[model samples]
Target: MATSSSRIGARLLFGIVLLFPLTYANDNAQFPYALTFGSSTLTASWFTKSEGIKAIQFPVDSKYRAYFEDALASFGKRIMRRGEWHVMAGDELVPAPPDTHNEDTAVSLFRDAAQQVSRNLSATLGFEPTYAALTLSSVFNQSSTKAATDAIFPNGMGFIHSIKSLNKVAPAACVAHRLDLCGNLGRTPAECADKDSISNLILVLEYEKEYLYVDLVFVYSEYRTFPSVGHEMLREFGEANREKLLKSMSTYDYNRKLHQTLNAFIESLVERQLIVRVDIRAIVVAGGASATAIAQLRKLAHNAVGNGVVKVVDEIDPGLATAHGAAANNGENDEEIERAAEDENIDDDPQSGDPKETCNNDAIEYIFDEQQPQTFDGDKMKEMYYDKDAWVSGFNSLMMECTKLYIFADKYSIPQLRDDITSALVGHSHGWGWWPDPDIDIIELVYNNLPSSSGLIRLLVLFTAYSWSSSPNVIAWKDRFRGFHPEYLLDVLFAQAQLLENEIHGEGGIPYDGMLNSCVVHEHLELGEEECRERLAKHSYIFASLLSACQAANA
Candidate 1:
């Protein structure tokens, strides 16, 4: 009775029913199994009814029913092991761990899958997979920091380490997550938080939702949890800069004239009645070149636009924040990352050592197409936070970032990702590291660790590297992407240029060119200011136009 669309799922259930070992416990699975938004697959080991929950959660074998029958639920997708990226529909077929019905094999397999939960292998089930140990704390802060960490970690980040620890998914570490101990107390440190207090004041308009930090707003238009699948408004997050706009909208004085200005501004724009008929995707704010361009944009945007979030990063080392956070997390290893730093001379300032050489705009011009770095003086200096120690720390922090990436990558089964982890373990840079010459041995390590199928993907990237990236398919894909973005074009051009330049014998674009000379960023901008700007604008125009075409087509 299954329709074509549900046929695959139907077969999956049939397989599970047949393969499910009858002797073991048939306990149902639970919710939020892994970080993957939604998942429901639990079965207890076979045992006497008195010993455990008896019966298959659902009568008919259906993915959702099985999950729902067990009181198991998740956000959107299932989490295999690492739970990083989902196995997209087009991915090559691979083996599923439990293979419950050999159903998952037709679809792509997750990277880090566990064949069985709990140590019992003969285990009785519930929620017993993963993790080593969980140490609850008297105070959230005490458990949050590096000071209290055990080498092994808990499954819910800090709740249970091994799958054998318990059955059924437990509530996340809640409440007093001590940020000092580096813990979110007992709660999870999700990416977004909002200023709820201000919402009441802004209710002057209907359809107006409150946003505090706004970065999280990208996930859900408001704080409400929208279903992950269909009928969604936007992606989980907005463009990165969206965070900046949110703060400025909330910037008025509650005391006097400024408060009046803020309130007036909100009323004029967000009141719902003003631009109710206009369906502009978002308000666009443009500012003439000025000393306070950002401020001007904010004021104008709040008055005219409904105030989508606007965020600006320091730009110099945006990577710094991510690295710092990863380092602070106990799951990440700092020493290996630090050691990788010691091997490089990336911080030499390009000026101090060489008598007359300056790493100024002129000096950095070698990579880009005749583009020189923008002459940086007082004004430019103010925009950047360039500290050597911080840079070093950031560089050192990459290993842990690699570790976190590993958790995601391994879970997701990305070929390139697997290679990166392998390379990092042996002290080579993977994707996270600036990639002139990624660490060869390290890449090998990641290759060694992958599941057979995932490892094959890693090997492809490796082979392409030694083969000068002339792989026909890669070239075709790059050429196709180049038609859309100027930046991507620049990268494609450079990679191809380097592939030929190295000739496996010469120097330029050689495999060992270190991070500085090799970073993909080097090729995007030319050294000559005029040429760089011209090309940048030209490419950006192409990208924009392509986007417009796509939008029009969809419309």
Candidate 2:
């Protein structure tokens, strides 16, 4: 029995030696721990219930489990008793494709569904179901994609589920496609020193672009050409109906409140001759309600002589607009727009009903030719809202306040609180999320404020996931600015493994966010299970783990 024990210990030590070089890169390595003796059998004290595993949780997914088992198998790992499993494969005990790396989240889900089966890999059909007692129990106290993390991306990566996959644009990404058109300026001549000049207007907004575009929207100088800043939208009382045009500008707080000012938009469209004004049924409408606003304006051009009509011509390449405008202005410099923005009154401007009481002047600032001469007429030049009648898919048309979701918890019972936090995590893979706030708002609400076990669970789970997601985002964003680059992840993981190990040695570990959760790795490994933490910090593993989390989120 003593010899047998020595043999097992020798292999484990050998495995750890073999593991470090390939797994941990660019960091000072820690020597292996001394194995306990006097007992003939391996015990559960090491991996499970160790504080280290709770910090920087490891072996993020099935791929991780696979690597560990493969490594242990070479040393003839196995479970000779209950409450344990082992890594036995050298003697044909376990076999998996050697080169197979679990780079995809699909591996985890392959075991998630009932009646799901595949000899190799698949989700729902091949993986164990989430509700399975064994699976849930295995996940109970572990820090893994399944155990601790929550999806942080709004609409989950814009739309993609996998981390390697490209993220879709946010709904607000349309802000990038924003454009403002001006008319009734044919005789106004591009403003030289005037803020309303077309050249200056173009210069302010066209700060930089690859191509220049000049859309000369022509209209008779005789009519009042509305400066198309905000879309002057019309409201509908019923199908094919147009209400009075709203004179007031939309509020940034609720700029999408089309329902409030729909009537004004439709009427103004007709008034602009962009659409036909007719009875809802009588007007030959095409393209559904989306075209209703435009149809009203088209009707205004009928027999009226010298009526205002909008014509769009290529003014310049969109790429060169800013550079050319800037270079063209001999007297104006970069500070010119800032000066104009600083002096211009935001509150009293009749044309701009934008309710943002004060403009930061620099924060998203731009300039363009002031549409219509700088006459302080009580009347607005002209503004148009976005296509509210179009499919306002998601929350486009509603500038709604954020929703607040609060789950109650007492200040005690930290362990059970963790379980509840786990339950919340399971459901987190899907959901629209709360509104009272921004994405990180809830963290502020709960963190440090909760004293109960349950609250700690919630706090830890959310804070960890939030922190984890940030690493990748920050890493990805480093190239955008100076001194912001994230070093390659290889070094990062090596450091993480060191941290988890030290924390485990300590009685309790504060999670990545500083809450204590029972460490399960050492205990589980003692029960013939392989460790998962080191693998989590691996480039391939973290990358793949994020992919799995993303996939689960999209799914």
lDDT of each: 0.26, 0.23
lDDT of 2 by residue, 146-237 (tens): 22122212112211111122110110011111222222222233432242322211101110111111111111111111122112112222
**Every model's TM-score:** 0.21, 0.15
Q: How many residue pairs clash in each candidate at the backbone level?
A: 68, 88
lDDT: worst 10-residue window of model 1: 206-215
| Cα lDDT, model 1, residue 521 | 18
lDDT of residue 343 for candidate 1: 69
Error of 2 at 322 (Å): 71
TM-score (C-alpha, index-matched) for candidate 1: 0.21
User: Per-residue CA lDDT of candidate 1, range 375-463, in tens?
Assistant: 33533322232333443343334433343344344543343334333322222222212222232333444455544334323332433
